[model samples]
Target: SGAPGSRVLITTRNVNVSRTSGVSEANMYQLSCLSDEDSWSLFKQRAFSGKSSDDYPELVPIGWKIVRKCKGLPLAVKTMASLLFCEFNKDKWEDILRSELWELTEGKDKILPSLKLSYHHLPSHIKPCFAYCAIFGKGHVFDKDRLVEMWMAQDSITTTARQCKEDVGRRYFEDLLQRSFFQKSRYFDSFVMHDLIHDLAMFICSGDCCEVVDGKLSSTSRVRHLLCRNERDFRRLLSCGCTDDLLKSSRTCYCVGDSMEPDDVDGAFFMKAMEGMFMKMKYLRVLHFLCIPEITELPDSLGNLKHLRYLHIYASGLTTLPESVGNLLNLQTLRVETPELNGLPRRLKDLVHLRHLCITGDFLGLTDSMGNLHNLRTLEVQSDKLNDLPESL
Candidate 1:
């Protein structure tokens, strides 16, 4: 034999990045957050292991209060618990529980200084990618593909001849994941950031690239990404003629809200407004309808988005993509969950940079042009009536 087998092990902050590095889920290991009881146990072992429980019974209650504030984060618990060795007093313990560090200020926090150090240690390329994740609301679950596509759209990912932008974007995601900036979701096939980590990102992006709309759009034109929480807020923002200004300078515009039945009554009018509005968004990279279920078709002007990379239309009502969809040569991810969808245009092949495609419908079949998507990496099709596989695939 002329060759030999090899094994490699890697440690990263995010699990998805570990998977991206070719480690199978079955073989991967996860470090779970410590439970409340276990968190106290670890803290006690480190802080009080040598002291008799009966010796410092007065400080027990205050210590418990302080530990609970750590929210079972081992590092936070450990950091707070270590303070006991230097000054084990009721007032000191109370001060930690009431520490101002719990409040995030522009990414600075005293509670978990070590975690902040980890955040600071991140490479320059991944720092913005992590900070941009603040665009998603707290506790919201998102997939790896969507985030990577958005990074590519933001031009955070660099491409080479052997790899496309999406591929490079994925590497960026993995870098963050391996470093523990992201965690796997317990309820969905997605990932969620720890509450403290999310706070860090939110603080970093504050008044910078990400803004969450409540009733009025910010006057600053520097807002590159916008998030709306509900339909009322969304409509309120659009009614003020904010769309024209926002789209002109924004790179990512999205709605993140609870699901609602498609707004059939106002759906057409909203779609028409968006169609006209989107034609002017030449620099737009991400356009998402969030949970709006009633949209049926993308505007014909969608092709004008030369820099578009991520397009997500949940609960779409249409059956086919417009032929102009072929014009989005830079598109990397397209996720359309439309039960009514029956087919895709053959022009899909024109999207040479397409990397991830997730569609749900009753498909006639895939086009032979699909084989032309040499850069495609993930294809998810949910169809009950689809039986045959395209030979070109």
Candidate 2:
């Protein structure tokens, strides 16, 4: 596609990817750390923006020391600079330069010390919101509203008397965005964390959040958040040697699937495994399944998750909710997106605390008792079969 003499440049953290692309060792180039002068220049540009370094003569010495600790890594330098951009305090700069986090030795594939310090410097309330992001995989695109709703479901947002939870959650997202923790995704209305930033989140959330991939769990610790990258990983987690206590301790479980749809046998296995898992995970606060494509029905035992607050399913084959769904007195948000679903549970009206309900299907089965859902605030239905609205609604 290029002129004969034109050269293609490829950059990647994984050497395997480079080799796989047919780049030989003779042609490969490993980047070295930047020189001291370059590092300082980059740091000064970010930390001072357009202002001259002379504007803050007192902090330049401390800034140089901090930049030296970054070892010429651009991301580390920029993150530390952003962390101190507006600060004019000498003591604050000195404190950052002398922090013990820098003394921590680097581990294989571990996050940079500067990134760790950036997370450490986050506000207390925003800390949990950021750490909770570890539940997602690297390169994951985040939806602002969906993430805010998830944070709300987890009680991560603290709202004032005048501000609603979504408003406060948006503020938290913007704060992170300003801090360079989240970058705008190429997709519209979405964002993504830099790979190193994602690593920092995973490192800080170590024991509390666990991710499963290729049938392997990142950690066996007692985790509150669990993520399965695909249906196979979820199945492996259910059938693997993981203890029942571990499942019982999880408060959030998210499963994301690829494009491949499951066969009849795989669907049956998935249903059986889900039933077994539902029986064990009693404390689950949020349950999400995206693109799994074979969930035709929910197990009755789902009602046993008395503490569940958020439930989301986006499978093409999902048909209906079990009647026991009404037992979730504390449930707040429910989102089911599928064209195959027939209707809602008849007892859904009993969930007085339900606030958000979104459904996409052929039949909604709305009843007069829907008026009992007095706390509902957001309602979205995508259906063509229904021609009339319930008077109670």
Candidate 3:
């Protein structure tokens, strides 16, 4: 399907899948557990949230005992360490050291019982937020602020009248980060969930969230959140008999083309599919597009998404946002990262409810009406053509 000498890389836990795919044994690779030294280093980094292990000499021995029980499994060690975070008492550490959860045999695909214990201990409000991440595929890199904004769009963050939702969302993100639910990615300012942790999230939200890969939908009737990994997956979604009703109930939809190759689908067909899909997802709260190089512009019908709160387009070929985008009265976050982009729509200044705006492109400057965005909390812009800030800002 690709040009001569092209290769496809596949990652999986099942050896049989690889063998069935015709991968030669000589080309196969197996990953082993972390070395004890590396495991301890990772554990200390998470458990103390950067505090030195020597400072808590008394707890060091108990920590090693807990780490040893983890069998050099990074996720297991981090889970147990996070559970012991901020606990100075020796008995508490010992209790976790002897938790019955560790005694349970590893389940299918090696879903460690320690991971389940970590999820069980998550705050009630944070549980759904974590589970909602099941919509993302394994190996997907996460943006901290973007993830929090999506949570706010879904009403996953709890806040009082005096508290700002953004603040609350940030707190929730930090809590998850500290608990090992998220780990830093090799890419700067990004995070990734361990494959095992991703599996746990999928298990937690199996009833409502669905992921479509290689044109296969896991669930249709009760699905509320959907992830379409490529053009084939999106096409499959459009051709599904229950599309209209399914789109109506969907709260979040992520169409990720980052993994797409140029030969995967014709550009025109992909755009046409996207335009048609947008018109049907009336109640969507969060919409994300990544590395969709064929997307030069968004459909005007995108503005019809009245309930949309978070919108992100990254590493795309987008040149301009439609003026109708301002019609999204509930939109809270808008991030566009594309060097090809020329400018923002003038009506963008009318989004009074917008809280975060990040743009990176060739734009010269912003419209003076930016002062109208009273609720704005974070503004980031990177442009070689930009000279000065608007007085209204």
lDDT for every model?
Answer: 0.73, 0.85, 0.83
Clashes of 2: 0
Give the distance in Å from residue 290's predicted Cα in candidate 1 to where it truly belongs.
4.1
Better of 1 and 3 by TM-score: 3
Error of 1 at 176 (Å): 3.2
lDDT of 3: 0.83
Largest TM-score belongs to which candidate? 2
Q: Which scores higher on lDDT, 2 or 3? A: 2
Off by over 4 Å in 3: 1-74, 89-110, 239-242, 257-268, 290-295, 315-317
lDDT by residue (tens digit), candidate 1, 331-354:
888888788888898799988888
Ten-residue segment with the worst summed lDDT in candidate 1?
105-114
**Cα lDDT tens digits for candidate 3, 232-285:** 576566556446787788888887754467676566766666677778889999
lDDT of 2 by residue, 309-345 (tens): 9999887877888999999988889998989988899
Cα error, candidate 1, residue 359 (Å): 1.6
Which residue pairs of candidate 1 clash?
Answer: 12-178, 12-179, 13-177, 13-178, 13-179, 13-180, 14-177, 14-178, 14-179, 14-180
**Lowest lDDT block of 10, candidate 2:** 257-266
**What TM-score does candidate 2 reach?**
0.88
